[model samples]
Target: MIELNDVHKHFGPKTVLHGVNLTIPKGESMVVIGGSGTGKSVLLKCILGLMTPDAGTILLDGQDVARAERDAFLARFGMLFQGAALFDSLPVWQNVAFRLLRGSLARPKLEAREIAIEKLRRVGLKPDVADLYPAELSGGMQKRVGLARAIAAEPEIIFFDEPTTGLDPIMAGVINELIREIVVEMGATAMTITHDMSSVRAIADKVAMLHDGIIQWTGPVAEMDASPDPYVDQFIHGRAEGPIEAVR
Candidate 1:
């Protein structure tokens, strides 16, 4: 399980997260939705230890992540970044095997390459594609490669940031389906941050709406449509006349 209790983070004069509290049950996919600059990304960063909260406790499987060994804590999770974040200089196989090659959890080169190829196959990529670099692939292929890397380490938990950000509707659906499949296959606890309603519908078991630096509402995906919360209603309907104001 992942739990954040009374978390607070500030950047100089700006406070991003304010007493944000949430608990994600084990093996569940929780999707957090919010508008841009509403601290959704900051919350993920705090959970990942890329940024620390000034106050609060973040626990992963009952262990305090804020104080845990950074490397050890991070090793328990895999992340699929907003942009695939693949290294243009490296071949797809090498990118997927990155952790297995240079970190404390390093494996032998041959074994790592084998594992990378296996993960690539898991994400619906052919073995021959592994020899290609990120620049040689299309956006959808890059996403597949990112998915391959995410599962390469076989992490206990996975974090996906805007998994379908730039994809067309069909491609977005494919990525969402792939994410759902991988999470279930690995039995990994998943938390995804996104603005795409299609992604939320495809990937979420539970949906949490982040607004004004706090979780405004949370419930099963089935209950989201009928939710009485105006903020959620506004977001899902894509309206400009609701409580959420358009920034200048």
Candidate 2:
């Protein structure tokens, strides 16, 4: 569903994502694991066309992303940001229906609301919570709302950025399970970037280790633990004494 071939991007003298290459099959979950500053987010932005790449091509469903119509290309995607990143001013239902109530994907107000409520329920939230504001909810509820918004448009591709960040371990686990279930049920191609191993184990069918601006190791999740690559070993095991240098 997605492919990156020799993708390269850099800012001035600093380079990130040097020759990133990988392929994600249709309707599968692929998680990218890497340390901070490894340009995981940058890679995502490049694919989304938010940032122009210095070199290389990104293809979505066999067409170059750069050449695709922006609205149509982005319409195929949904994103769950690192934090819930909810709009404080909007009520929960409105937040979830934000896409459906706007350009390209717009629907009748009542239909959009119904879809929002259903998506909220899919992420394990009750309808009563829909009328409330983000501040009225707990962290878990807010995250659920984010997930609801992500799938509101029924996008063909979903990108999760640190989906478990800022949650208690139990809540994180809940989110991971929800993500895994939803992606499989919807048959959407999933790409996630996260440092959480629990999230990786829960959501990933394939694991890609990105380091030094390229993919160091990539294979089925079943092979990740037993892989012999030093970079993969250091990352999945959280070692301070391997190929990856500790930030501190």
Candidate 3:
């Protein structure tokens, strides 16, 4: 459903992605694992057209995303940002229905609210919580609300950024399971970038390891442990003595 061919991106004197090539099949969950500053987020932004690549092509469902209509192209995607990134001024339901209440995807406010509530329920949130603000919720609750908002529009593709970051192990596990369940239930193509190995295990069908701005390994999650690549080995095991150099 998504393909990147020899993708390259550079910022000034720094190169972030160097010929990234990856293909994600329809309804597959592909999780990208990499150390910090390894261009995982940049790769995502390139795919989403938030930052245009200096070289190569990104195709979504066989069409070049660069040439597609911006609004229409974006309508097919949903993203759960690293920190949930909720709007402080909006209530939970409105935040969840933000896309539904505006633009070409817009629906009546009442209808949007109903859909928001349903989505919240899908993410294990109660309907009463929809009336609360982001500040009123716990960190885990905020993540669930963010997730509810992500799927509220029923997008064909979902991107999750650092889905398990900044949560307790138990809460992270819950979020991970929720993400896996929602993606499978919706049968949506998913791409996630996280350093959390637990999340990769929970949510990935296939795993790709990025290092030095290139994919060091790509395979089924089951094979990740046995992979021969030193970078992959170092990353998955959190070993400091492998080929990956730790910054002092």
Evaluate all candidate structures by whole-model CA lDDT and list the values in order.
0.93, 0.94, 0.95
Residue 145 C-alpha lDDT in model 3: 95
Candidate 3 has its poorest 10 consecutive residues by lDDT at 239-248
Query: How many Å off is the CA of 210 in candidate 1?
Result: 0.5
Kindly indicate the candidate among 1 and 3 with the higher TM-score. Answer: 3
Candidate 3: the clashing residue pairs are none
lDDT of 2 at 112: 93
Could you tell me the C-alpha RMSD of candidate 2 in Å?
A: 1.0
How do the residues 130-245 of candidate 2 rate in per-residue lDDT, one tens digit apiece? 99999999988888999999999989999999998889999999999999999999999999999999999999999999999999999999999999999999888998998898
* Best by the TM-score measure: 3
Which regions of candidate 2 deviate over 4 angstroms?
none
lDDT of 2: 0.94
Please list the residue runs of candidate 3 whose C-alpha ends up more than 4 Å from where it truly belongs after superposition.
Answer: none
**TM-score of each prediction:** 0.96, 0.97, 0.98
